[model samples]
Target: MPHTDVQMDTHDIALETPPADVFMAPSICKSDLLAGKSYSHFSPIPAHISDDMTTECVLGVDEAGRGPVLGPMVYALYYLPMELQQSLLADTHHFDDSKVLTPEVRSSLMRKLCTDGSDLHRASGWATRLLSARDISAHMLQPAQYNLNAQAMDATIDLIKEVLAKGVNVKEIYIDTIGRPEVYQKKLERIWPTIRITVAKKADSLYPVVSAASVCAKVTRDAALDVCYEPYQDTAVNEDKATEASTHVAWGSGYPSDARTSTWLKQNIDPVFGWGNECRFSWGTAKELLEGKTADVKVDWPVEDDANGDMRMTDFFAAKTEAGGDELVDWFGKRVTEEMEDF
Candidate 1:
């Protein structure tokens, strides 16, 4: 595929059939606030690296759907032989310059990349961490506070660490970052002193590897968004196979600013529970709709009389013994003085 021009706004990613495989749901984040959880997938080592444990390679990292108020934020890492970085992806496949392809084109490229025995498939190894909306919203909304940036950074680092542990001779790393690139660059450098690392804004446009990673992330998130809509596709589908579901693209780009997304949120929200796990409740858009005048009933959570100070003295000593006793002295192993009679 030749490199095209301009990035589509992703408002109407017309995938006739949503790529359900990418919307993995096996793993989970441990949190009471989350209605759903996140998951990950790591591609098997490429055949090209099977024979050589120390094969020199270059890796790139990028993410998609970070700003969307709906769907998961997918962080992806793609790597291949350092020498083939330019020749194979850039020159042969034209995966260059800011992923200058349409949604269909990107999807097509990804399909080819995933095909067994394909040139790209045999040469490259990749992975993704799909952060579910419920998990993300719950984290950000938690009392301690874990924001998106920290979550993004951890996902990136986890991918790299897994690659290293798998013995993929990573020689250099390139990352597409938002906000202070130099700080991220230095942090990575400190962690992996041996590998050369570059962290920059728009690294996707500057580096072919990052561009390919961008494609992987964007395609996965788009397909996942469609999957997220499956539960709510009732109104648009017909019994006839010939009829297409109008709701396929109804959710729009999922950004808070998108008119279609705003309308969809208004139409689908539950009066009591709000939207499904696909929504990020922490976002101002979702929060406002759930608590604003549009809401059917005002919700007031009951407060405990002493939420933070409910712990009693018994809590500290409960684990020490399991004796039957109503008094504190009887709890202490039938009293030491009675035990002294045995001595």
Candidate 2:
């Protein structure tokens, strides 16, 4: 779509909606979070699109919670008629880089976007993919499997694909990048050759669509943290203990540097388990606890399964075979013949 010039004052039209219903119920998504997975959410489709309108659309992508030691990392895509990007966002909606907006302002902007009759709601479509804390930890802790960068790339690609699958006419795409812009831009270009792509550092501040996407991703992440509760409990506990265990415990911004977050980590860490599903055990603070303070706990990595043989490193040193190659087999046989001992 051709960029349009419109004369309008920022904040000329104010909009309002009911209180935030942005977060899903803990019961609805807690299982997925506990299982260490990502879940997606699509904003309600606008009521109508003008039949005469055939403008190619533009999409922007950004993420939130990338560095958090708790909660989910959310990647969001925001798409709208290309021509209206500047006028609708900069001139009217007053969106900038979401980090610049106060929490109240971010919530307000999202509420307007969700409100049915508002121009933003009518003209825009957005989606978010929330990569849970448990899942992030699982990936990061894996031996040479997926790292945070790999997970982020997958999430970004998945979000864009999801938005396109919903049938939005996405043409030009803008992205805020965590790494080298040239590398990320080239990678995306190879995937969707026909679509124009721009990947840049701080693209959210440079492009309104990216800014809007940032707001969506940030607000959703914040709301998720706002409602986060312990996904697993051995038994039902009293409200006081339950509250002490979960949502009532405030973790400020989930950043390791935040004083509140560090304090929460120090206060709630289980000596053996470390923390609940809310924690990214692979992160330094939690990792240190397991490695430095609680090293006495016998922990196993790369658990034995149908694919991997059940051999611990200690077994090789403790047993001897004729050729040494068969020591594990002999060790197992001897263990079966005698009493087996736990590690």
Candidate 3:
């Protein structure tokens, strides 16, 4: 994939990736998220905005699907007037409807948020950054690793900057943090000196704005997962897999702990490429499945012969041949001892 440069100044928030069925879902494009690339989407700037930079609005950032092994990690931001924070989000719209995070409720809330002329839609604005499983795995698996926390922080910052640049009167910002909440909060404060930034462990459950942001992120991830299997369904390695891959029939929750997901991965993995881009190759479970003893093929990666003396498997075999050593004895690392019982 080519390096994608996001246009920050333009209101054209449509993702630059391949087109998708717009009617499918509001915040998610399955192909875009699972196409081995990361992308961002911005909701249309709310028309109920005044040009006053002094206008006080509260914004929140939250993420979803961070632990899942099969779907995109979505980072979302929501901003609305500070006065309306209670009246609009909490009371009227019920952004904090549930004591626990509920996927079903989030989906329903997201639909309302996206609906035209809805109070939630007309008064607030939002954006999302969908980090694809493939892109994430690629970064972390590379020689110079970029960890998930860093990637997440960058994505969250990008969403906030996008909203700020679009002239949102952001006065206070709240974020659901991954690790080192104080450090994250300080970093965000350094970036936006004027805005009061708050980063908490469960900011989503505590703050109404953060809860709304969580709803957007969760709904986007769930919808993306539903469509993630579409691309691989037709071109599956086997007919049985093709039948099963039709819209996540047995794909499970995309978590490594889930037996159904592990079964799906085992049954559908390609010996050469592992599973499709839906799987995060950087995850320990994925690595073990692809490279461990149970793998269908034991692939030996080619190594460069550097001046410092790098070695390949073939080099060792060749050295044994030159030494006139028995291949079986050397391969098995076995040697007979005088007192050995099983030697």
Candidate 4:
């Protein structure tokens, strides 16, 4: 993956290694939250490079917002030269698994990394794929192409590709996994024939690189949710009420178990659209509310989009044409030809 310089005017927003806040107000489409992808770079103004540089870099991959019913799922990658990985990341900075860290600490560390003068900024580089809720729902809802695991894998791959394109020499990769570690490891090994890959349970806690990636992923997700707000196009929600609704909806952690998230879903569901693009419709919590709680709507399934699979009343009674002979055949054939066109 190649890196791009995303210029941010403020200190709070996540940078690209540079990529959030707790309870921050959602900004309305400041950038495309749903379309395309974003990445960050964190290194000295003139990135250190040498023609004879032989040090292979270690990289880690981790994600946040997977369980959340709302907000984008974030995949982040943290990479630095392999030799300096532990000394700078673990001993110097004390980076650890993001789950155990408080929101304040994560935000603070990410902020420092974004700062130009910091040692962490000079030594490390990171990037993220902000997989939107709308994209996730649309993928899962599609009958033939639906699979969350595959979707996650693709996001990771895209991140790595972007990193390599940006001139990072990643020789070894570590990943924290939600699936069978051996299986995931084997899959990634097959994908990247040359790079050493390890997918493990709690890899984030064990490896500083993975832990760094976790912070990048976790903090980006939190900030994304913090600034998450839907545009006020909905006619049912009054502008005054909608403006009131926008300020801190208190969707705690975006997990289904969070009482605040559940309460927000119930109180804010649109009935017709369910929730804003922030909420994933494929998730059980969102789906159940839309189907069981909202008013019933009659739907015609198996929508006819293609030319095949069309049936008509004439086709149904075609077998009876044998009994009626030529007279019936002529009557039914005429009806079938004209009506089949409509079907």
* Best-fitting candidate, scored by TM-score: 1
Candidate 1's residue-wise lDDT over 1-343, tens digit each? 1111112344333322234343332112324113356878788889898678778999999998887778888898999999999999999998853245666667777887788989998999888888999888888888888988899999999989998999999999999998799999998999999999999999998888999898888877777777677667766556677576444557777776666788999988888888888888888778788888878878999986886396787765553435554455675576877889988
Candidate 2 vs candidate 4: which has greater lDDT? 2
Best by lDDT: 1
Better candidate number, 3 or 4, judged by lDDT:
3
Query: How many angstroms is residue 24 displaced in model 3 relative to the true structure, after the best TM-score fit?
Result: 4.4
For residues 86-144, write the lDDT of model 2, one tens digit per residue: 99998998898877776678888888888778999888888888888888878777776
Global lDDT scores for all candidate models: 0.78, 0.73, 0.75, 0.70
Candidate 3, residue 73: lDDT: 85
Error of 4 at 298 (Å): 5.7
- For model 2, which pairs clash? none
Q: Write the per-residue lDDT of candidate 3 for residues 248-306, one digit (tens) a residue.
A: 34565676666666788898899988987787887877888888888888978798768
Q: How far in Å is the alpha carbon of 290 misplaced in model 4?
A: 0.8
Off by over 4 Å in 1: 1-35, 97-99, 235-247, 302-343
Per-residue lDDT value at 317 in model 2: 67
